[model samples]
Structure formats: C-alpha cells, structure tokens
Target: MKLIIGGAFQGKKEYAKQQFSLQEDQMRDGKEADFEELFRVPCLYHFHEWIQKGLKLGWDFDGITERLLQENPELILISNELGYGVVPMEAFDRTYRETTGRICTKIAAESQMVIRVVCGMGMVIKNA
Candidate 1:
C-alpha cells in the first residue's frame, strides 16, 4: 500500500494520478464509495471524509487498516492532513481529526511508499 497526503487543495490526487499512471475511473472517492469498494479500489481519495462518515455511523474502525493492507496491498490512499491548526470545540470534530491522524500514521508505517504533496509537488517521505 501507499499513502499520499497533504492539506486540502494541495493536489494530492493529481500527483498520485500522474505519479502512478492511474486513470480517473481507477480511483474511488471515499466520500461515496461503498464500504466494500475500499478493498477493491486501486486508489481512494477523500479518505478522511469516509472516516468521518464511519465515525458518525458508529462503525468500528479497528483492524480496518490491517484489512486493507491484507486485501489490497497495492492500494493507494489519499487523505488531507488534518492535524494542523487549533483544536476543535466539538467532541466529534476532535475525534474525527485524531482518528484520521492515527489511522494515517498506521498506514504510513506499513506503506511501501508515503508521499506528502504541497503546492502540487510531491515529497516522498518514505519508500521501502
């Protein structure tokens, strides 16, 4: 698996596409993808939004990263960095932010490659 992350509008998606030679249809938008689609899709963007939805729906995220790694070892995930700025006032907001960070951290540790995009440029932070 691989991870591409950056702040919103940082062109992570474009970079991932160009870097991997992926087409639009080959990537799935996490916001609307079915739960089962995650394991089947080659790439998934807007992953943070999908996590938020799962949290709101009381879905257990435990072992999900592991499942993805096992089921789709070649998957490329794109998520917006959400750990910056002031803390949120709402409890749910805080949970969502922290959950996304923790999950991304886990994914990064196991990913064969991890890239951070900024201003449409990709900086490879990790490469196996």
Candidate 2:
C-alpha cells in the first residue's frame, strides 16, 4: 500500500492522485468525538490518539496491510505532518503533536509510496 505523507495544510490528496485513483480510507474525521471537544480540537493530533484507541476496538491497521495483497488500492491518505514545527506550550498540544508524530512515522515506514508536499508541490518520500 502506498502511504502519502506531508505537512499541515499541504494538499497530499491532490498529489496522491497523480499515480493512482484516490479513495478515502479514512476511519477518522467522519464524526465529532467527545475527547476532541474536551480538547477544543477535532484536529489531527486528537484523531491520532483516538484512532489508536479505536484500533484496539477492532479497527484494522494491519488488515489494510493484508488487503494490499488482494486489492490494489489507490488509497489517498492525508496525514498532517506535525514534526517539523516549534514545540507547543499547553500539555494537550505537546501530547497531540507527539502522538501524531509517532503515528505518521509508523504508517510512513510501511507505505509503498511516500510523498512530501511543500508550497503546493509534491515530492516523493518513498516508493515500493
């Protein structure tokens, strides 16, 4: 599976479509959650931790890995790259950035393709 990754607000999806037809496989951002409201953010950071929690509840991070063998997915994944910025002050802010960083790293490593979009340009970060 190809994992296209990039920084915040960069059009990662616009690039992911250059090679493969795009499909949204996101298990996130479809609904508003409580934890997100508590943090006053329904942002990537909150979703990062929330997703891991859901994964334990039977969501398939690994199943996507296995599905690659049976299906060729033009999976267009949009990830907010949070590692390249300044440190946050609030406790929640720090936690969110850290969690997102870890999640992105893990997924990027396993992807067949990786790309970094900067200034509306897409640069390939990985390939199978």
Candidate 3:
C-alpha cells in the first residue's frame, strides 16, 4: 500500500479518491477502508490537536506512520504547508503554521510519493 501526505486543500485526498474511482460521498472500499475510517468519526476535539501532538510529542506523526505500515494501506493525508515561508506574527497563526509543517514532515516521510499543491497546481515532491 502507498499513500500521500501533504497539506490542506492540496488535492492530495481528492487525487487519491479519483485514482480509486471513489465517489465524493462514497466511503472507501478494499483493504484501505479501515484506515480511511479515521476521518469519518468526529474528531474528538479540536481537529488541530492531531497536528500539535505531532510537533510537540510526535504523537500524531508517529501514530499515523504506524497505522500506514501496519495496515499497508493506500493513503492520502492533506496538510497545510507553512514553512520555507514567512514567520507568523500572531500566536494562533504561528501555532497553525508550525503544526502544519510538523504534520507535513511526518506525512511526507511515510509517503511513497509527495506533491506540493500551490495555486491549484500540484508539484510533485517525490517519486512522481
């Protein structure tokens, strides 16, 4: 199984579904279904918690990596890429941007392929 991890609104997830012929409203099928179910259940709290944990204690990042290999599932996890750019001036903005970078790092590390979608265009980052 293979997966993509990038950023929010990067078309990562969309491309995955399209590649699999998955309907917009339809759930995933095949061996990957269980992994996909992670997004189906309501996020316990602020969805951002997942990202923060990744940067702070590597909880989110490590967890995702374990799941990917354990399930050997095809995946596409989107994130907001915020590094290699400006430093956020506000606290909340800084948190969001920082966490985005951490999560992206984790996801890309496990990705067999990676792409950076900017201005609606996806630039392949690895093994395109």
Candidate 4:
C-alpha cells in the first residue's frame, strides 16, 4: 500500500494518479464509500473524512490496518494532513483528528511508499 498525505487541496489525489498511472474513476471518495469499499478500491481519497464519519456512526475500526494490508495490499490512500493546526475545541473534532493521525501513522509505517504533497509537489518521506 501507498500513503499520500498533504494539506487540504494540495493535489495529493492528482499526484497519486500521476505517480501511479491511476484513472480518476478508479479512486473512491471516502466520504461516500462504504466501509467494505476501502478493501476493494484501488485508491481512496479523503480518508480522514471517512474516519470522521465512522466515528460519528460509532463504527468499530479495530484491526482495520491489518485488514487493509491483508485484503488490499495495492491500495493507495490520500488523506489531508490533520492535527497540524490548532486543536479543536469540540471533543468529537479533537478525537477525530487524533484518530486519523494515529491510523495514518500506522498505515504509513507499513506502506511501501509514503508521500507528502505540498503546493502540488510530492516528496517521498518513506520507501520500504
């Protein structure tokens, strides 16, 4: 799996497409995709939003990383970098940010490549 992260609207999806030669239709939007879709899609964008939705729905995500790596080793995930700015006052927002961060960290550690996009440029931070 590959992980692409950046600030909002930083072109992470586009970079993923160009880098991997992926078609736009092949990528799923996490906002609308069901949980099962994550294991089937070739690429997923807005991953943090999906986590937020799951949290709102009180969905259990235990062992998600293991499942993804096992079920979809070729998946590419694009998430906006969270927990970088001021902490949110809302309890849910804070939890969402922290959850996304922890999940992303776990994924990145196991990913074949981890890239950070800024101003439409991708910088590889990890290759394993």
Candidate achieving higher TM-score, 2 or 3: 2
Looking at candidate 4, the ten consecutive residues that score lowest on lDDT are 56-65
Tell how far residue 105 is off in model 2, in angstroms: 0.9
lDDT of 4 by residue, 1-128 (tens): 99999999999988888889999899999999888899999999999999999999988888999999999999999999997879999999999999999999999989999999999999999998
Error of 3 at 8 (Å): 7.1
The C-alpha RMSD of each candidate to the native structure, in angstroms, is 0.7, 7.7, 6.7, 0.6
**Which residues of candidate 3, in runs, are more than 4 Å off?**
1-20, 26-62
- Angstrom error at residue 122, model 2: 1.7
Candidate ordering by TM-score (highest first): 4, 1, 2, 3
Cα misplacement distance, residue 3 of candidate 3 (Å): 6.0
Show where candidate 4 strays beyond 4 Å: none
All models: lDDT?
A: 0.94, 0.51, 0.50, 0.94
Tell me the lDDT of candidate 1.
0.94
Please list the residue runs of candidate 1 whose C-alpha ends up more than 4 Å from where it truly belongs after superposition. Answer: none
TM-score (all chains, Cα) for each model: 0.98, 0.58, 0.53, 0.98
lDDT at 100, model 3: 59
What is the C-alpha lDDT profile of model 3 across 4-109, one tens digit per residue?
4344566654665555455555533222333345444221112233455444543344476666556544544544455656787888668767665665566567
Model 1 C-alpha RMSD to native: 0.7
- Residue 48 lDDT in model 3? 39
